[model samples]
Target: MASRVTALLLLGVVCFGFAAAEIVVDCCLRTTDKRLPLQILDSYIIQDAGKGCDISATAFITKVGKKLCVSHHSKLAWVKNYINILDKKKGGHQ
Candidate 1:
């Protein structure tokens, strides 16, 4: 019984290590290259599980409640500004 528990613990650690090694270029979204005609409901920066900050990508929640990943590194300044405006409006302070 003790050996079984030890083996499980070891397996869990190995799984976690493998996950950490895997590169998360963009998470929870398959495509982040093209722009989608999605109305922004909310937006924020995605933290790397306390590893560091990812400023290039921001998570966006749509008006219909679908979550999406949007790129913040844009050539147009209005895109970034628009997301911020939506975020502020959602919080009821802007």
Candidate 2:
């Protein structure tokens, strides 16, 4: 019985270690070209390629809670304008 208890404790430790190592890193693997209405957007998160991601993107959150990734280097004027608007809304000067 003592040996069984020790085996169970070891199994638990290994399982916990695996669970801890399964850290989910949310990164945008691709970007969308869809020009969504600015009114539909609620907020945004800027993702950096240097920060565990392969591409730099802007993750825009829609009013209904949907995430749309767009390349940070996109030449679309509306995309930049929307980002600027969101920044201002969040009290960021940019």
Clash number for candidate 1: 0
What digit string (tens of lDDT, one per residue) describes model 1 on residues 1-94? 9999999999999999988884654454332645656454544444334344434455666666666665543543555676557657665111
Would you list the clashing residue pairs of candidate 2?
none
- Give candidate 2's whole-model lDDT: 0.78
Q: lDDT, candidate 1, residue 77? A: 58
User: Against the true structure, what is every candidate's RMSD?
Assistant: 6.3, 4.3
* Candidate 2 residue-wise lDDT, 14-66, digit = tens: 99998877343878899987777888888887777777688888888887978
Q: Candidate 1: where are CA atoms >4 Å away?
A: 1-40, 45-55, 73-76, 92-94
